[model samples]
Structures are given as C-alpha cells and as structure tokens.
Target: MTTTPRSPAYPSSPLPSASPPSPAPSSSALSSASPARWPLLDRIEGPADLRALPHHGLGQLAAEIRDFLVTKVCATGGHLGVNLGVVELTLALHRVFDSPRDVLLFDTGHQTYVHKLLTGRQTGFDRLRRAGGLSGYPARTESAHDWIESSHASTALSYADGLAKALGLRGETGRRVVAVIGDGALTGGLAWEGLNNLAASAHAGPVIIVLNDNGRSYAPTVGGLARHLDRLRGHGPDAGVADPAPTAGTLFEHLGLTYLGPVDGHDTRAVEAALRHARSLNGPVLVHCVTAKGKGYAPAEADEADRMHGIGILDPVTGRPPAAARGKESWTSVFAAEITALAARHPDLVAVTAAMLRPVGLHRLAEAFPGRVFDCGIAEQHALCSAAGLAMAGLHPVVCLYATFLNRAFDQLLMDVALHRLPVTLVLDRAGVTGPDGASHHGMWDTALLSAVPGIRLAAPRDPATLRELLREAVEYADGPTALRFPKATAGPGIRALGAMDGIDVLRRSPHRPLDVLLVSAGVMATPCLEAAAALERDGHGVTVVDPRWTHPVPDALPGLVARHRLAVTVEDALADGGIGSALRTACAERHITTPVRALGLPLTFITHGERPELLARAGLDAQGITRTVTQSLTPRSTP
Candidate 1:
C-alpha cells in the first residue's frame, strides 16, 4: 500500500519483493457473488490493508470490493463498467508498487475508480461526481495518493517522463515512476510524443509504463495502433517471453523500452508477477496488461456499446432503472436525428468522431451513411485537421465531439481549419456547464475561445427545432468553418418567435409599453431570457427578449435592436469574460451605437458539479438570478 518509493534508486535499483505470487482466484470467486458482504473491504482502510491480506484472501477481498463497487455505483451512478474492468489489475498494481511516493499516474483518470478505492477514497463514493463530493477523475486535493488531475486521455506518459526526469534531477531517484495508460490513450499524438522522448532516454533511470489495454475509450479503440497491440498480445511479449534486454525487436523494444506481458489482466497473481518482473528491469519497460473493458458483471459484458462506460442511477440486480424513462429528445439525440437527416439530402456529407461515436451521437449519421463516418481515435487534433482535409476534398465533414474535448483541438481549429477557411462544421455536444464530472469536465470555455477564431460561424441552438434548422443551414454554408453547440440535457419545447428583425428572432415582445431592457439570448439561453423577461415585467420593467440564433461576429441586427432599449443585457451560459455580451459591446462601439450593454453569465471561475439547473442558478445564469442581477444593475446608483 505504501507505493511511496524509497530514497535514491540509482540506475540499477533493486525491486522490492512483497510476497510470493498469489494463486489465481477460482472461477467461483469471480462468477458468483460472495455470500458475505464486503466485510474485508469495510475493514480495509487503504492499499496497505488490502496488500496485507494473504494471496488466497486477495480473491475474496477483490470480490468484496467488486460487490461494493456494484452496490455503490448503482446508487451513486458513476463509471461502473471501467471500475469493474480494472478490479484485479488494480489489485495487482497495489501489490506490485507503492503509491503516492512512487508516482503512479493514470491516463484518462476515470479508470482510476479502483485506484481511488484502493487509495483510501472508498468513503468518498457516496456523492461521487456530485457537488462538494469526490471528483469523477483523480483529484490531488482529495488525496496525497493522486498526482496528476487531468481527466483527458493520452497525457499520462508525458507526465511520467517529466516526473522521472525530475526525480533523477532532484536526486529523488529512489522514487519510481509508473504510468498506467490505456491502449485507447496510446492512439493520441501526445502519448506518442512522450513515447518518442521516453524511447530516446532509455538510459535515464527506470520508468515502468503499464499499458492497460482495455480495447476502448467510449467505444472500441480503432486504427493501426489497436491492431499492433493485438499482435503484441498474440506474441506474448508481456508473458516474460521476448526479453527486451538483448533483443531490440518488438515495437516497444525498438522504442527503447523493455517489454513484458500479454499478462492476463484478470489474473491478479499473473499481473503482479509480471509487474514485479517489469519493476526489476534495468531500463524503461512496458508491462502489457490486457484487461476486458467490462470484465466482471454479465450486464456490463453483454452491453456492447461502451460497456455502460458511465451511467445514471440503476438497479443493482438488473442494471436498469425501476420506471420507464420520460422526456423529450436530449440535445445529443436531436443532433443525431437532425444530422442524419442532413446527410440524406447531402450525399457529400461525412461524419468525423474522435473516438466517441455513440457519446457524441454520431452513430445515427454513421448508420445513415456507413463508410462516410471516420473515427480518428482519441486524437482530437487529428480529427479536426483531417476534417479540414475532408472539407478541402469537396465534401462537407461534421466534426462531432464533446464541447470539453474540442478544447483539445483549438490549435488545429484555428490554424488548420480556420486559417484555411475550410467549410468543416464542428458539432459540439454538451455545451455550457455540464452537470457533473467536476471542473475539468465542464464545457464552459468554448464560447469565449471560439469567439476569438476569425471567420468561424458559431451557431447555438436554443431548441430541437432550432438545432434541426441550424444544422441544415450550417452544412449548406461552404464559405468558411461553422460550429453548432448544444447542451447535455433534454431540449426544451420551442418558444415561437413573436417577430423577426434583421436576422434575430424576437421570442418575447413588450411592445404595448416602452422597452426598458433588451434581453439578447444566445442559443439555449432563450428559455431563461423569457423567464427573466416575465420576472422583470412583474417588477415594472418592460423587457424584450431576442434570440440571435448566431451569436458570433456581433450581429449588425443586434446593435440596432439594443439602441431602442435603455439597458441592453446579453445572457449566455458561457463565461462572462470575453463572452457574447463583451463581443456585443465591442461590436456596438465599432458601429457607433452608444447603448450601455451588460454581459450576464457564469463567472470566470471553476463551477462545481451539481444539478444543471442548480449550477445555472448558483452562477446567476438562471431566470431568477438574471432578473435579480438586471434589477440590481438597473437600480439608480447612490450619489457618493
């Protein structure tokens, strides 16, 4: 449990021997749930407690822990499939290496649920990914055991390399560095950049890279790299077969890292022994631990789509909610339906996804036109640039991604996509304050960031109908780049337009009386803007709410509309700084329109995970909060 590596491990540092290799757990231990509850799991405080158990007892402990996770995640609704997949591998890791001091970094930290549970965070699971509770990913603030806090994939290898070098430089060479990376993550360019560097520095102390090949990142990992991993697993390089000491033969060996394993990731004893061997190697090494994406439970195994990668509250026994689901189409579903329809009319339309087909709702598009969809693995940068290629090749490519993930490809978006003025349409799902999964996962910065990109037509759809219409319009615009951002929740009922101006849709009009407030709503903010308008009317303020449909370039129609009202307020879910309202004010000044415009939005701070509406209200992006802010801003200033 004490993975805190000892002091001064020189080049030929000796690997610590914990105990003899434990016997593999019997099928009964894995197949059938333990009759007794998590007695061993409850007793265990941390990794040390779990590690101290005898070899045979480890199986019972793992079973207890797995059962505990199933029960806990069923109620709490967290990353169920991933945690279940890594149970035995996690046990092996705790057995092989000490944590905290050893610098055990996890790529795409969602897989660290088992790691967290083992590292004395079992108690934090009740409110997992909830407000003021345990984060969905590894959090350094939560525990000393955690180091890197990035939830994004494919950067752990780089951290491992840097940490290894720093350890050597600071004479903390005794501390070992191990990066537990997924095969899916290995597809990212950043991982390869680190690999290229780490391979070149074979002589710079030992750093063990544990390749946890789960064969997935939201979906089955695609491309040439996955096939290479398959060949490595088949050849049994990880089973202590092809020693990298003399032979520079295997792919990893050529990369200057010793190879070990096709180790059974499900077999705790085998993985422990293989890791121990890897730890003892003279130079940098890779321990390939092939694990199933959803290993233990039948429901997770049977469910092919992402193996229920992440899910809502579910019945423990059936993996289903008690009642039938009810709601209008979600934003993702709407995009899926609309985009698929767009593809039917436009044969030249193609869909591109960065390893997330189902999550971003690209499957519908893929189904409509099978080969037209291209999954570019976990490489968002490549996804964007390649989408530019598709656009340049006389085809309209919709680059579908989560709003948060799109942040990874900003450079590509600006340089490759925008500089070339490609007609690629970026479809960003889960825009605005994503409810849970914590700060790192929120899609808060897209609006501010995208606004800076020149010639990019950004469309924020407020409802299902708008999304349908906007997508059709975006695909048809071949002059330059376009993006359509939508929220995660179900789309609300459409608000019919009261009237139309230059290009804006007036959703609510207070024409009977003189308008004191001009409420400019961008995309999904239309709902709250109308609510705020009603609230303002009750307080003797006649508010006119308009949906610009497109918020970028500071629409010419907007400044003119704002001139009619005394106080112009632009509301958006994006960050207040450098957001839509700021853009409007700047645009109005350029056009010589003197109306005072105020930006109302979420503050430029890390908003915590909570219910979407609750977070919105807390951030003053909700109706009551907006009304309160506008009322306060409109109040006459006291003479100083």
Candidate 2:
C-alpha cells in the first residue's frame, strides 16, 4: 500500500498555546521549551490520513508522533513510556484495519496516547488529568473508535470474546474485534480465562489478539507465562524442553488457536504484515510483537526500572522533573523504611507485591531480604492467597498492595485469609483518593470492604510517625488479618498520643472536661480533624479529637467517650457509606449510646483526577471543608 506524508485528520488545527514553566514549588516541569509543530502530525486527523501516508514515510510519521508524545507528556505528565513504545504498532493496526467497523481495544489503556492523537483528540493533551481535562484513560464519550472504557489489566480478551460471540449471534460477520494486550497482562488470571474460552470452538472466527510484549509491568512480569513467552521467542531458557525453534503456533496453538510472530514491533511494515496475516484467519490468532519499553526517548530508554512507566512534570531535553523536591516522604516510602527495620528483627517476616515492586515501595525490602520478597505480577488474588499459605506455614507475611487493587482480592481476603483467621498483615499504599490517574484509580474502597470481613482489622495511619508505630502494632497482632493503610501524598505533621483509651490515641482534649463534640479521626484525616476541632473550640464548643489508630475493631472506649459529648463526629478519607463513620455510628448504637453522631467523608461518587489537596478539598475531606461541616452541625434546626 502506498502512503502519503500527510493525512487530513488533523484538519489544520493549530496547537494550543504553551503555558509558562510552573513555579519551582509546583508539580509540573513545563516551559523550559516551547512545543513543536509537525506538518505530518497536523495532517493526521484520522486513520484515513494515516493510511494515505507512503509505507516508507510511515517510519518518519512514527518518529514525529513519538517526538510529539515526549514533548506533550513532559509538559503535562502522563504515561510517557508506554505511548513511546506503541507508536508503530498502533499505526500498523489503524493502517491495516478500518476502525468503528473493526473494534480496536487497548487492554490497559495507558498506551493510548498515540491512539487519541490519531483519532482527532490531539488538542486535549494540554489539560490532561485536570477536572474538565482529557481523561488519562480512555472514555466511551471520547470517540466511537474507543469501544471499551476500561483501564484494568488482562480483561480485554474477555471483552473481545464477548464481542466476538455477539457478532456471531447477530450474524455480523463483516465486523471484527482486535484486542491489543500487553505481555505484562499475561500474569493476570483473566487473560488465561479469556484465552481458555476464546480457544474453544464456540467463540471462534475473526478475533485477533495482538500481544504487545515489552516484558515489564511496573517491572519485569513475574510468572510462568513470562517463561512460556521466552520459550515462544526460541532459544531462551528452557527452549529445548518443547522445541528448540518454537514459534507463536507452539504453546498458544496447543490451546487450539493459531499463533503468529516474534515480529519486530518497531518495524511498521513487519507489524502490518503480521496483523494482515492474522486478520485473514478464520479462527482466533495471537500475533506476538516484541518491542522495547520506552523505545524512543533517551531518558526512558536508559532507565531500566519501569522505563518511567508513569511520570510527573519534566524538562523536555533532559527529562528532569522540578528541581525542588517533595518536602516529606510519601506514605509508601515511610512504609518501606519501617518494613526494612521489621524484617531485620523478625526472620520469618516476608513481603509480597503484585507486579508493583517499585510503586508499592518493596524494592528496598526485596533488596534486603531477597529470599523473603515475592512479586506475584498483576495478580492480586494470587498474591493474597499465597500470603495466606505463607502465614499458615510458620511465616509472618505482609501483603503490600495499592488500596485500589485490594478490592480485586476480596475473595482471597475473605475465604482464604479471614476465614482461616490468619495472622497476615496487609500494607495498603495509596489508600484514599489518589490523584491524576482518574476514577478507576482512587483507593476509596478498602475500609468499606474490610468492614464486611469478620475478624479483619483495618488501620488508617494519620501521619508519618503513626504509620511507623501502627504498622508495628499490626505486625504484632497475629491473631487475625490486619491492614495498615495510608494515602499516596507526603506524610503530614505528626500528631502524638497524649493518652490512650482502649488502644485509641487521644491527640487533643478540651479543657472543658465535658466536650461538645467527640471527634473520632480514622487514619489520614487526623490532621484535618484536629484543625476542625480547633475551629469548633474557638467558636465556644468543647471538642476532643482522638485518633482511633486501630479503627477496625471500633475501640471499646469510643462509645463511652461518645456518651460524654453532646454530639459525635467521625471523619475519614474513605467512602462515607459503610466507611469508618457509618461503622462508628453502628458501633455507637450497639453500645446503646444515643449521642448524635455524624459521619463526614467523601460522598458516594467517582472522584475525578486532580491534585490530592484539591480533590480532598472538593470531596469535603480537607481542613476547611471539615470545619465548615462541623460548624453547620452545631446550628439549631429550624422546623420546616
């Protein structure tokens, strides 16, 4: 096929004006240089424009797109490495197949930056991740070409299978479904489950599974699947066990499907050829393309660790973020230091992370005790069940996971660990309302989920010192499952325990012994709770602020404390429904205490991506929001 250097998709859309470099104190590293214009990219308004380009000029077009990615992503931080890696592969697919009639889905949509550009959403890059900005992930509202609105890993094959089945039932043979899944996604059980169904004769015909293998997810994917992929590549550890010269038709074919490739993903023509060959087949086919993560950008290519999987603001030329650093350690870093110390004291202590070795702060712990740490890959359920087994086998296993991911392992947490009453500790990082990755990312479900599990205890650490202190307490409590959760932001000013009541930390006590409000703070909300309490006190209401460090058990002293105050208020960072506040109210009722208790937290809704502080304020979990709520609570109700 002949290709033109330009496409009519862009429709002469001029670039958005470049903003000045952010202040040293801001999160971005923009404005060191202005954005560049690409006559080639400007012409690319749709797939038709991309198809019109000469096959030889397609290479230059890929280069221009890659350059555009680095410039825009550096100016406004997003997934830089994955987008850089998928340029040629994306172009090849778009060039070979007609979208809309042919559905194209990205498994974990972080790599869809190039897709968005080619689909006429190029101008949305400027406001990426802001409230009204272009979403960091795909949205059904974005375009007709974007068929699915999911960012979860390893679920694409299942979606494709369902779509393929639907098309068969409706006799829509003209339409096709193409799923582009990362090799890193293979570790998840869903991928295998989908493959099992897709390989069957029932869902056969016109389903192309494009396995974009870069060999890492946050880090190198850790599982049997990676080894199988290595064998499929031929002449890599354990090659002779099956066939010395194995191809895609080897392992996947054994499952009753055709396999094609070991194709150079960077070669546009080669990828197009592979895709074309797979598209012609009457049954499901797997086209394996091996590419480098962070393919073009020098900084990303040189960085071996995660290939800059997700990034903050940075200089375009050197890829340097802001010179000023975060003032304090993030909750994950704090957990890392404590876990390292705990590992030193206890020989049986072990940690497990699901594919996120670095992001969850297990790298140092893994380095210190190589034998004790395990990376289960993007497989959360497996990690939890494995931790349960480790706990049963005379080991103290701590499952370090992101709060958003913990929801995925509810079954394992309930049946495997909680039912057995194992002494496992779950360290939850990025626990509440994480910024910028969008709705699917906010970790606001853990407290609610754990509340339902019998014998499970959850702790929300409010500050750096409490995280360290509480994590140690969680480790020592070996009778049942315990979780120590904290948000992604920097640890705030520490609030010390002035006194203890049934394992609760009394941070502040009103001089007027009889308090107007019993402020029960669950985890990271302690700082805001204290500020809100001060505001209440200045307004002539007696307030007592306490941090229920071990919040899950609903401290025995809490009901009695609640009875002392005229009213009780519980503040948390989790979802208000079934969260700490609701739990506290139920506990209060169970103890026959009738103090008017109010629950303050994020309302039941999908919190959009933005800075942590800004999102918190919007959710009414910040100091001012809390203070305003508390003040309104004190007002006398007018009879309507």
**Tens-digit lDDT track of model 1 for 1-640:** 1112211211111333332322323335434455454677777777788778777777777666667777778787878888787888888888778887778898999988888888888788888888888888888899898898978999998998888888888888677898889988999999999988886773455788888888888898898888778766663235435545444245776666667766677777777877777777645778888888766666777889898799888777777765754445788998888888888899999999999999999888887788999999999999999998888899999999888898899999999999999999999888888887777777889988899999998889888888888899999998899999988887878778988888789999875877788999988889888989998898778889999888887777788888888789998888888788999998888888887899988788887777788888888888888888788777564689
User: What value of lDDT does candidate 2 attain over all alpha carbons?
Assistant: 0.82
lDDT for position 345 in model 2: 93
Q: Total clashing residue pairs per candidate?
A: 10, 11
TM match of model 1 to true structure? 0.91
lDDT of each: 0.82, 0.82
Pull out the clashing pairs in model 1. Answer: 3-98, 3-99, 4-101, 9-173, 9-174, 237-261, 238-260, 238-261, 238-262, 239-261
lDDT of 2 by residue, 175-218 (tens): 77899999898789888999889877475447999999888888
Candidate 1 weakest lDDT stretch, 10 residues? 1-10
